[model samples]
Target: MDRKQHIAIFTTASLPWMTGTAVNPLFRAAYLAKNGERKITLVIPWLSLKDQKLVYPNNTTFGSPSEQESYIRQWLDQRIAFISGFTIRFYPGKFAVDKRSILPVGDISEIILDEEADIAVLEEPEHLTWFHHGKRWKTKFRLVIGIIHTNYLEYDYPRSIVCNVHGVNTKFLEIGKKRFEQQHGSNQAFTKGDYYIGKMIWSKGYGELLKLLHDHQKELVGLEVDLYGNGEDSDQVKEAASKLKLTVRVHPGRDHADPLFHDYKVFLNPSTTDVVCTTTAEALAMGKIVVCANHPSKRLLQAVPTTGTEKLSSKKFASVSLNLWKTIEDTSAYVHHLALGFEATRRVFGAIPGSLQPDEEQRKELGLTS
Candidate 1:
């Protein structure tokens, strides 16, 4: 919407860092590049080392502190610029996603101002607590709109911040009101994939989801839940699966897309932190039913309100309910919102916002009919 603004995406980690959170943004930038309008730049601490080179743009590079500020120095000491208006140097990594820590809010804010960003797509506010509350930043451009890919709200509810959802909760998948609009026209189920790929993390409800599969082993006759992605809890996940006696096949990697194509039935979204899962959207686009842990992030409460529970709430906006379709629509809106920004510059936006041909192509390559 603003004059073809320069966009810079800075990530604490690289693509597939942990399922949807890191992967989607890089894909979004790659998609924008197709339109050949707005300049897109990605500054991540580390770029994932996966086999598939075609899925993500070749342009993206990495410079971040991995072994404690070593990479951070590299990013800062060297001026990194990839695309026009899109630039990323380095920011101190002092906080986890939900954990509160203000490391380089001032420095990042300076970069946002220097670039004259129309919008700052912040990952986790705990990383930039200062800029999250800065009202004066609006004088520059749209403020930090946090991308809640986890489906569960992780923050203490920072004020004046809006978020985007990726998919339903961790256990169930339903069509969102907005997401179902196109599907209702056909009344057809979203395309089902044979296998799914994602990080096997705790909040993902992998244990319960495996129990459901193990209990419903008969129902899961032809289906196999495949998992890929790295985290600290991989062994625990394997242990749970073994305990549950799930017949899931797992191929683990950091940034690798499996060579085998799967007709995935359920895209496992286990994140309880944010609202949407990028891989969930990737799965949906691939035509799979996403079984997400709705409100996995919040503490269990007796009363289950819409988004997940009544306990969690954002600062200004009331936390919405987490359901199957709700997640899809929220994520779709975020993508579409980004698309509006990307398209405003001249690139042909995809049906899904902040996405491009690779989405369709990637899925098709995976043998997805949709």
Candidate 2:
């Protein structure tokens, strides 16, 4: 009989955050754990004070300072108290240690030492420090896998382990790609002209879309930009659009498959720091032209190839629609290629070897004495 493989996945972000970098890998990890017969543990950080305040404010029983600790402990305990059949256990940690700074009360190193996992996967850059500097778990875990969701990890990483990255979903990016394709039809047609869907944050680049509209005001006569979704920056977004003298409408939050996709002609993604946004892929899957204001990092440029996607331009904002059939053809190919890339990465983790080493150059660059 074969011994079950013990794997531990670490992330500084947890559910309800809505940030793709933290959420995507967790989703992928859950999918892998459920499908495999291995024992998996997910070590995640506690919600930050800011997020906690935003989520449970003055109106609730968690308002008082003295009661905050109890409430937090209660929340963490409840999160782990539930049992599931997937063979994956969630271990919430106190504070997270990153490269540049330490997250207050978010440490998970003790949990890592306790697990004695055969395989360890690090999702955040700071996780590498635990293995590299802590030394205890370096030899314990046979393989230490790393995942780089964006350019953040491209600059510096531990000399040890391979960090896979540079990768999307289609109509609604919030949901899984397979589910979206299964329910909405992968080759569905889109008739709507121009719209933006996602969080109203500065990083997502909603303001850039407004600028495009404001710049092309004369050409896009009678056309109004529709904004959907809510975030901490919602008021700022409204204020920016008002200053631009752009007509923008706010819609309540809804699922990705809401009829909105069919109501717009083109989809715009102006995100400044996205690795590869799900909304862009969804628009591609629906055969809609996606107008991107800024380019993604070089490592992730393949995921947002120029073939099916358009670079935002000052000249042709209003006259950039392509033929429906051609647009669909380009997007369909891109979607298929993206799906294959994701599956390949999943297989890499599922079949990792017992022991691994850092390349010679990597070690030399880091000047590791050990």
Candidate 3:
């Protein structure tokens, strides 16, 4: 095992962003703070009101952007235990998790050099380009790694160690296991139903899920569907549900640890662009059947194969197979698939190369710093 060491996390968004892509890095920082012996510093962007309203409108109830920003920073500070190394400053240029934008790497390199960090954790290749392949300035840190939290891997993979955040065990998963499971046990309440907990966006495939429900209205007689999270497609989802006359419950905010998981029979994950949906894994961990859309992530696909056209038959079940819905309707099949999927995900968690020891030769082999 590697000895305890200092880690500096440079993220593309502020701590308050609720999306898994934005919050995964925070989970990394928190895990380091709680479980490891290390000095951790988190540097994140402070978004403007327009950006805040665009991403998370329901969570930010403050009167102004300044208030929201202050509240969020204070909230995170309390959680991470703020100190001299912790930083929250606005990026000099625009920054988005999915979009291609260059960070102010010159300013960021200065911070790394000033802090004398042993490891610098970049969010993605867009971030690593600033330091690893620098022209004007280069980061002299012992190790620099990229945290690939999404599906954007078109650029040439970097030479240094690269990691996907969802595949790793995080503070969110640690606490969720202890908290949500205790509140909601293995005892199943509802005999048959469906639920989806994520942003209400087209990319999330909620609109398609609603369309499936609409198309299979007669097939879904006794089953109920619950939708959580808010986004641009919130109104559209509700409207579709209304048109279909499906008994769909819409929750305003995210709720992962509630009794909702135990009460539901199937967890719907119809996301189209998600690399690795942690919430889906969390639901599976809680012992619920998951029917998700097919994706290309080898880590996820290893467990849930892309083949198999068998669809379960039940009036309480609905699946749009033509639309690429990977339906898991059998109780035994669900358990087997969830176990396989979760096991694959857990294996990835064990593979994260974080804070290699000063004397480790593997770091040298990978051209990473000790």
- Against the reference, the lDDT scores of all candidates come to 0.44, 0.50, 0.55
TM-score of each: 0.49, 0.57, 0.62
lDDT of 1 by residue, 59-142 (tens): 333322243234333432332233323333443232222322112322334445555566666655434332222233334456
The TM-score of predicted model 2 comes to 0.57
Better of 2 and 3 by TM-score: 3
- Number of the top lDDT candidate: 3
TM-score of 1: 0.49
lDDT of 3 by residue, 1-370 (tens): 3655767787765534456645667666666666546777766544334445665556563344346447755655554433433333333223343433223322344445444567778765354342221221223577767666556543234233323345443333554455455558874335557888886777778778888887888988866787887777788777777776668888775546555455666788887555667777776666566897666532355533233356568534544542334333344334533432343442343311221121233223223333
Model 3 regions lying over 4 Å from their true place: 1-4, 59-106, 127-140, 152-192, 259-262, 303-370
Which regions of candidate 2 fall more than 4 Å away from where they truly are?
Answer: 48-50, 55-106, 112-116, 127-140, 152-191, 298-300, 303-370
Superposition error at 32 for model 2 (Å): 0.8
Candidate 3, residue 138: CA error in Å? 5.6
Best by TM-score: 3
Tens digits of per-residue lDDT for model 2 on 1-370?
Answer: 2666777776655444344544455545554565567766765444335334443223242233335434433433342323323322332222222121112121234455544558777765443332221233345577877665444534344233222342233224433344345448765344345777776566667767777778998887777677776566778888777765556776644434556555465777777555456666666655566777546432225442234245556445534543555567567545533432343442343311111232243234323232
